[model samples]
Target: MGDKLTTKTYWESYYSHNHADKKHIKTVCGYYNDFWKTFIDSKNESSTIIEIGGFPGRYLAYLSSKFKLLPTCLDYNSDTSQIEASFRIMNVETYSVLQKDFTKYKTPQTYNYVLSNGFVEHFEDYNHILDLHVDYLAPKGRMLIMIPNMRGYIRFYKYLVDYQNLKIHNLKCMKLKVFKDFAQRHDLKVIHLGYFGGFPLGVHQKSNLFQKLIYKGHRLVFKYVANRLLLKKPSRFFSSSIITILEKQ
Candidate 1:
């Protein structure tokens, strides 16, 4: 990984140029919102949440729609006008957006939940990054971390389909034991650890017709056959992402 400043510049430029489209945001927000709602349903409506690396605030907007929350979004990207506009479009009020690096940012108050998705893997010093997230959690608060599971079947499919630009992912893999060790080091209890989402056949988007057909066929199998057969056992080998829920001790 690059130096802190170099990493910051990369993300700033990335976000500045690659804002998610409304449709994509809606889809991702819906997926993540389901997980949040399921985990937090019993909590008070006034629960506070801080989403580190929440660039477009789509997840924040979704949570706001379901519950009265105190949301704070932190990201290195300085220009968040588009994200603010998205919040307005979603009718989400009472949220704060901060332009700061999570590894160094300090908060006066800890939160009920600290959330991150596709964030920690960017850094070489992921242990430090994990510690930073835990520092912002109140006692017994939950930290939700989601990252691409490179060991999963999606990687194998990409290789088989000869997916273009496979080298783009900064981090190689997020192993299950890595997360368990991180939680143990911080004295945080691992409440939930599992893989979700189906195979990522979408990575072959730029490939040939045969590759595209394979992608679609695999998607259907996951949707119809694999899902029914494997609903009780979401394999780390096949799932696209790994989700880890930890509670502060």
Candidate 2:
């Protein structure tokens, strides 16, 4: 599928209707913040950070507020006319937000930190965007990537879930071994890789208090037991929402 048509159908639909879960949103923001603090060593205040696929400006704004650095966000959703005015606000003074397809846009500037949360997998060609970002990065620059795990527990339960009927799941997920090989081939160092979000498979069923309690217990056990023993692979957790930080050599 063409980039324009595929992006609109997948991103706009999710941003408009599916991304309303407060807990999921919180986990995402926290993940990025921790990554920044761990990797940047308080030096992010002076660096240029670019966030790809930042929707509605919430997480970008949150990161901007935390690091005190302006984040340039590139997104495919150009129809800002449909988004709420409150969702359009950004805090960075030096940063610019462009609503364009990254695959087609060329730039002369390099960034200190190139970050994309749940974006690279969406494109038909993963290496294409990865090469672009690596080329766009300054020497010693780092990149933070987050994508859904294809082998994660939640992905197995998709048939039992109704709201996740979207076809973008391919873009949303990747096998870890394949990803590691790709990163190595591209000269991107995988400095860290691990699970972040709790298994998303059972989150939907936790609508009621009783279900929520049971789900919470299940999550705890899965994290320490099922994931460590039964599944043995960390990717089996929560449909394997994997977060990885890569640095260009």
Candidate 3:
């Protein structure tokens, strides 16, 4: 736990307050839908699935209807009131809700597919849990992970505006190289990896229309300058977020 705030309390409060914040939550759901479509691509909807760190289970509810089955949702904080409420609201069946810490929980079975959104970033020992997941992954099964990009231009701007700092190091940023190396170490194959929000209108949500339009334009302009002018070199430091897909090697 970090000294300034307890992680469990932080997450509990976040989900409790933000789960029903319609616009923001729906925008997040849209991102999940888009990313899942990219990976599944017309596959049968009744695929066996599991989601680690399934906060509030809103995505799980959406996915259950779309995929034709309720997914098994696992979380470290099952005691959170929001978590319990989510389970009731989502009407999730066939779940193994555990309150155990993620670092201590071992993977139970080789799943056909495992999905996590904004999960790996919070943990200090992320790789260990990742390795466990890979070990329990069925052959050819896929693991999808999404993370905020630490080196993104907007984050750079945030550093200057919010903290008056020229640079900031986001511990959550898992560079592609580092991810690839981790995969290789675990005998997992890197199937697909890329940025999510570096194009016009790519943001999931914004506070207002003006902010939306401006940020959308900012994303496009930066992407153009990063890709065309810099020969995509700036991409290493300019993507707003990252999505990684991996298969067992």
Candidate 4:
């Protein structure tokens, strides 16, 4: 999140009503998908992972409990109750929270895995954001960065719907070429880099009558057509997300 655009309260307020409850939050977070499994597994149970800007810790809770990996969360949000509650519900015991600005926060310790879901696209500076993530990442450890694919055909739908919501996101970070450049510049190896998932139009939003009708048709069509398509061969035109996996020298 950008300091100039989004304040700490913005996140707290956003997440306050973002979900119905701690348990139900996982549903909105989506499944950890087949694409993620290629990089999600750990070499050891003690291998640590940290989620930057991971408020609520949905992914952290699931990864920690399922893989028995130690987890940490870094965010500007001061409240950790929901994150703690998520861990408790998942029966995760080894987890911690780093409550502060991720861009500004300094840490002597590094983690085995560093990930950020739907993050890094909020700020204006991708170079600074990527550098910060690398700063706290351990050598040979994988850093996974995922962001919504707004540059695709969905851009038009979002423009017709929530244009303001689109403004906060740095859609350029969703580009594969951008991350490839970063990896080369930093001497980090790209493990996996590509688009993922077919386009999903079912999730609703406030829109005009015409936009609503158009999106409704999309909802019906994508429900069947897009669902059956191969996820590994995601195209930049309408893929739901961009995933990049990098390892340091």
Residue 8 error for model 1, in Å? 6.2
Could you estimate the TM-score for every candidate? 0.81, 0.73, 0.70, 0.90
| TM-score, model 2 to reference | 0.73
Decide which is better by lDDT, 1 or 2: 1
- Count of clashing pairs, candidate 3: 0
List, residue by residue over 123-187, the lDDT tens digit for candidate 3.
55666656656654677777888776656555544443333221222354467775777788988
Model 4 accuracy (lDDT, Cα): 0.77
Highest TM-score scorer = 4
Tens-place lDDT digits, model 1, residues 1-249: 243423566655556653435666677777665567655644588788888898877776666556777788888787788668667766677788888867667878899888898887766677777778877899988888988766656667777674442444534447888888888888988888878776555562366788878778897898777865554566778777788888888
Better of 3 and 4 by TM-score: 4
lDDT of 4 by residue, 52-150 (tens): 988878888777776788899988788888888888887888788888787778887999888889778887887678877888788888888888888
Question: Cα miss at 163, model 2 (Å)?
Answer: 7.2
Better of 3 and 4 by lDDT: 4
Off by over 4 Å in 1: 1-27, 32-34, 41-43, 160-166, 170-173, 208-217, 227-232
lDDT of 2 by residue, 1-249 (tens): 254225466666556654424455456566556666655545547677777776665665556656776567777686453222212343344556778778888766888877777677666667566667776677788777777664544544444342244244464336666557757877888888776544554443225575456556766777666655433444444545677788878
Error of 2 at 60 (Å): 2.1
Residue 123 displacement (Å), model 4: 0.7
* lDDT order of candidates, top first: 4, 1, 2, 3
